[model samples]
Structure formats: structure tokens, C-alpha cells
Target: MKNNIILSWIEEGVVSIPSFLFSEYKSIGLTDLECMLILQLHAFMEKGNSFPTLEELSNRMTLSLEQCSQTLGSLLTRGYLEILKGHTDQGIYFEKYSLQPLWKKLINHQLLVEKEQTEQQLKLEEGSLFTIFEQEFARPLSPMECETLAMWIDNDHHNPALIKAALQESVMSGKLNFRYIDRILFEWKKNGIQTVDQAKQQGKKFRSHQQKTKVEERKKGGTDTVPFYNWLES
Candidate 1:
């Protein structure tokens, strides 16, 4: 019976385990062995909904019986897994392990902290206009572009709100760059774009023609790339 139980356990990688066990495993931080055990245990449980035998877990992890038993005991004590009731050819065995809820709560807290850190970093980045300029253009603003942006923000006292909105729109549409902003201003100054709606409409028009030209030129083995600033200069 012991041999049969061991063989059955060998067939399955998991000893009976509870969900809370892995949650605790994550909280205590899983070592390589623990991680391997968790992965194998999960697989075994998935197949039979029973605990894996000592031989089974060892085989799955390529570990010695002693090593697998010791690790399992540690996990059981750490509140990461629990054994339920079981019977086998060898005799009766404890059930698979289970996790406790406290571990789940802790893991959730850690995830929340990570998410907040990311959001805070983004907010700090968004605080500065220069950072936005650098990211959008992939290169620093040219002397002329810098001068225009500075004048627009500092001297003309242009609506900071509108500038920010336009900047965001440009970046999202992949049309962001000093030349793009300059073009928008040039047109706006010429009665071409006066509001966000007009700016969006202009972007759509540019995209339509840009796509059309690209497809046509590609068919002819030619490129239809144009420098946004060069068009204005011409």
C-alpha cells in the first residue's frame, strides 16, 4: 500500500494544497525551489484535485525525496499550503495544501503599492513641459522652435491650457514634434485652425493624404516621405 500510494503521488506533482498557500508563498517571497514546487504542485492539483505523493513532487521538480519533503514542510508551516484528508494504497495521506486569506491581502497590498509608484512617476514626469517636448520630438527643439515655444508661453501669454491640450493631442496622434506644433501655429495664425476641433480635423486630413501617398508610392518602389518643416519653408 505504501508503494502504491508513493506511485500515485509520483504520478501527480501536487500534494493536496489550498489556494491560500500560493498567496502566502508570494508574500514570503518564493525561492527557486519554492517556485518550482508551486508550479509543479499547481499542475498536479489541476489534473486530479488531490495532493501529490512525495515521489510525484520530487519527480516533477527533479528533486530528491528528502529535499521535496523538507520543502513541503516549510511551506506548510509558512501558512502557504495545507494538507487535507486523503487515502491511498500505501495508507492514508494528508490532503493537498491550501493558502490562507491573509497572504492574499498582503499580495494585493504589494500590487497596489507598485501601481501607485508607477502613477506617481508619471505624474512627476507630466509636471514639466520640457520633458514632454523631449519625449515627443525624440530630439531637442531647434533654436527657432524653442524661441517660438518660449515666446508663445512667456510673452504672448497664450492660453497655457490650449497649448497643453494641443501638445497632448499631437503626441497621442504620433504627429508630435517642433515642426508639427509650428505648422499648427502657422495655420492657426492664418485662420486654418482656431480650436481643438479644427486642429483634430487638420490632423485627419493630413493622415488621409499621407496614407494615400504612401500606398501609391510604395507600389511604384518610391517613398513618399516629406519633412514637415521643409514644406513650411518652401
Candidate 2:
């Protein structure tokens, strides 16, 4: 008897509900009862009953037929549901429900949320970059310096982290000026260095080359120490 019941239950099939509907329905301004009605409608549509009567829907839920009708009306008014007309090959016309608007609202809401998150993250990064620059320079940035920083990010599309790395490189070379930092950025760009690690590797190579040149200079009896890398020369 239990095996028969299980088999019958399996034969009844299952309704596929989008996972986001459960989590985000409330955010999209759907009340719990309205969302439940939508789920019931989805189940009926999935089972090939595109237009279940309110009596049939109410039979499955605690709501009365009139309540189901009113809830469906609310869904229609809110643009979350639509009644679409169609015709069969026999030229018979019928009305069916379409959940396309509901799906569109969910998708558009998710995209808007992601866009907001990305914008917030960009603002935080820009703020932190400015703070780091001010701390390193030991003074507030001038209006022109601020404009240059914004230009590097907004116009030149340089990564803030990569710019920070360039500033560090300038500091290490004892040149803590905007022009020196700009030169470092330009040299890194010319060398196709898009990341801080790549810039560091390139710096290592330049230092090695400088060391080899100094050795050759020593052999030629030249004794002026090449202390800092001149990115302007590079």
C-alpha cells in the first residue's frame, strides 16, 4: 500500500519554481499570499492547465474562490501577471496567463542591485586611493592634483591599485611628485604592465640591467653611483 502511494505521488509530477522567487518575491513588492497564488498558477500552467478556474485554485489552497479571483486581479494590476489571448490551429481562441512580466521584474531588480553594488565598490576604492595619496604626500592634494588623479581613473581607466603601486615606486625612488608618478604610470603602460606584480617584475629587470651597466662603468673607471631609476629616461 505504501509503495502504491509513493508511485502515485511520483506519477502526479512536480512543479518547478524558480529559486529566486522564494527569496526575492517580497523585495519585488509581492505579499506572501500573492506570491503563493503565483506559485499555484505556475504549478497549474506547468501541468498543462494554462487557465485554471478560481474554484480549482481555491480547492488547493485555504483561500476562497472569491479571494483567489481578487488576488489574481491584484497580480494583473501590478504588472506581475498578464492574461494573453491565443488561437489554436482549429481557429479556436483562448486566454492564458503569462508570467513573463514577473520574470522580467525579478531579472531587472537583480540587475539594478548588482549595478548599485558595483557603483558602491568603485566609490569606496576611489576614496581609499585618495586617502592613501594624501597620507603618502603628507599634505592635502591640490585641486590640480585631485583632477589628475580623477583623470587617471576616469579618463585613462587606470586601476586604482596599479596607481597605488606606481606611487609606491615613486616614493621608493625618492621622487614623491605627481609628475614622477605620472612618468612611472606611463612607463608601466608602455611596457604593457596592467598589474602591480607585473610592474614589480619589470622594476626588478630594470634594476638588474642598471646593476650590469654599473659594473661595466666601474671597469671603465667611472665611479658615479646610479642611485634611483629615472622612469622619464626609460
- Among all windows of ten consecutive residues in candidate 1, which has the lowest summed lDDT? 225-234
The TM-score measured for candidate 2 stands at 0.75
Model 2 clashes, total count: 0
Candidate 2 per-residue lDDT, tens place, 1-234, comes to 999999999999999999999999999999999998999999999999999999989998999988999999999998999999989999999999999999999999999999999889878888899899999999999999999999999998888888999999888888899999999888888879998899899888887788888888889999955756878777
TM-score, per-candidate, Cα-based? 0.36, 0.75
* lDDT agreement with native, every candidate: 0.65, 0.91
